[model samples]
Target: MNWVRGDSLGHGTFATVNIVVPANGSTFFPSPAAVKSSLSHNAGLLENEKEILSRLGSSPHIINCLGHDHTIENGVEFYNVFLEQAAGGSLADQVKKHGGSLPESFVRRCTRSIVEGLRHIHEHGFVHCDVKLQNVLVFDNGKVKIADFGLAKEKGEKHGKCECRGTPLFMSPESVNDNEYEPPADIWALGCAVVEMATGKPAWDIRDGSSIWSLLVRIGVGEELPKIPEDLSEEGKDFLGKCFVKDPTKRWSAEMLLKHPFIKVDSISFDKVHEPLSPPSPSTHFDFPHWASTVTASLPSSPYSDEWPGWSCTPESRLRRLVTDKRPENWSELDGWMRVR
Candidate 1:
């Protein structure tokens, strides 16, 4: 399908995501699609993502990849992959918009979607090495789909002993210590994501000046587990308990988690209880001390190899503030947008 790219939705370390519309004024293609593009020379990750998405096939819980192709503009060749646009942005954005955390019911709904997506990925012999809130997109129809396959790998894929592929905050113990990236690692990350959704904070208590070495030690060295949120339901905590087991083998798989009481509600029951009468107000008692603010830490080169340069510890609230501050007044307007080529 011929399409035209609009303004960029966002850009990450490797590629830019732009809103795309079907060209020739046709409605045959999915409305409000997105195109992720990168310079041909640096498009390996994007290409890999497309290939992985193709292998995963169609699942309601997984983002749909429409197509992929190359285009040349201004004498520069670019690689682009078309995707279904999630109108509700990302789960991280949702957590921030809801004032740092989500209600337990909402968290359950989102967790179920993520588990289904992960189950599908794992059943196909793949592991989503990065399964965090930022990679889970929310749709307008009150659904969530797992996105971003840039770090995905087939089950049992080997890597350099010192290589770490996911965000440090969400890395599983085995991943941090043994360089293992498998389905269990994804489950660990999912648990971390669930904690973020329920508590409005990272699973591990990472202070402003925490060093990468210390964080890595906390995750990899001991029998430590991310603290379960006190306010969560007992079943919710139990579900997380299954996910946060220090032993990856004991950690619950996506298939098992789907049946856990925390997220086992049927669709009909979920729809009835999912919609809140009013938006949940932010809890004023929850303290936001200065130590919880944004932090940037440099990864020391000695302990781990130089493969990883550094990482940032930006909170979702800070990211939400940035987006609100920079968003255009006419941001909702989608018509008469510029074309990609």
Candidate 2:
């Protein structure tokens, strides 16, 4: 089977998935060393990643696993793991396309999903050391799933090296200060993700890289953070502030974010604002072939069946609704296409 290449939903600095045929495609990070090797092995970070994904697999908030793509041929190979696709797009794109500022209520819903995914992984004895807008995947049906296992760690495990594996802007001060880190460190990253989504750019993106770390250091110690636009709702600012707590444990959890009052105030037509087939610029990028087949794919109509492999969450709902629908009889339809919203 071949994954239809829509656009890059996401790419890992350490590795990238080939995006074969698009319902969630394979994770090619630990791609086989060579076809010569049967049962090819993973080395370095890839090995550590294997352990993390094993733990995350136990969580429902994370992507569902279809199985590892270990098939190999002469000089050719497949990815190590396969997962469901997020047809909606990444949180990064959503925030960008929506004018760098999202409604306070929407931010709440997205934040709730993030914390839930974090909670799910951590409860299973793992920490998603890397949490950021780029790592959070959203679907049109309002479902959100966490991705990027390269920076994850299990509970009780000793902190690892301080190498820069995650996006610099989202790195937690605790993670940078100590060579060895823990779950608290991840909470800091989550704060950055929330702030960026609420404001449209990273918390420290405006600063220089070398100095940015220094700036984060200041914020880590309870220094006054930069001003959030006044026009943003009070509820939005409040939600953003909750995650910005200097102390990681004190920060809100996924369940708490879901219930926050800020996220409850949706615009009159907020749900309707995210209609499919809308134009996507640099921001609002998507990986859903269903939308792409009509807009960018330049096809006369949707190529896949209305009820093919994707989630039951309708594209019309704008991903505000949770896709509680149980598994369809089949799910491989979303396998290979990457599209922009």
* Full-model lDDT for every candidate: 0.73, 0.49
lDDT score for residue 236 of model 1: 90
Reference-based TM-score of each model = 0.81, 0.63
Worst 10 residues of 2 by lDDT: 291-300
Evaluate residue 309 in candidate 2 and report its C-alpha lDDT on the 0 to 100 scale: 21
1, model 1: CA deviation in Å?
4.3
Write candidate 1's Cα lDDT for 219-326 as tens digits: 999777899999999999999999999889988899999889889866313453333222211111123221211122223322222222112222342344334553
- Tens digits of lDDT, candidate 2, 1-341: 32333333333212334343432463442221111001233223444455567656656567555445444433544334445555555676677667666666676667666777777776677767667665676665665678656556666675335343344455555544553346665666776776767677656535322343454356455565544545667776776677666556687765566567764435222353354522222123223222110101011122222322211112333122223444333212234443311
Clashing pairs in 1: none
lDDT of 2 at 330: 26
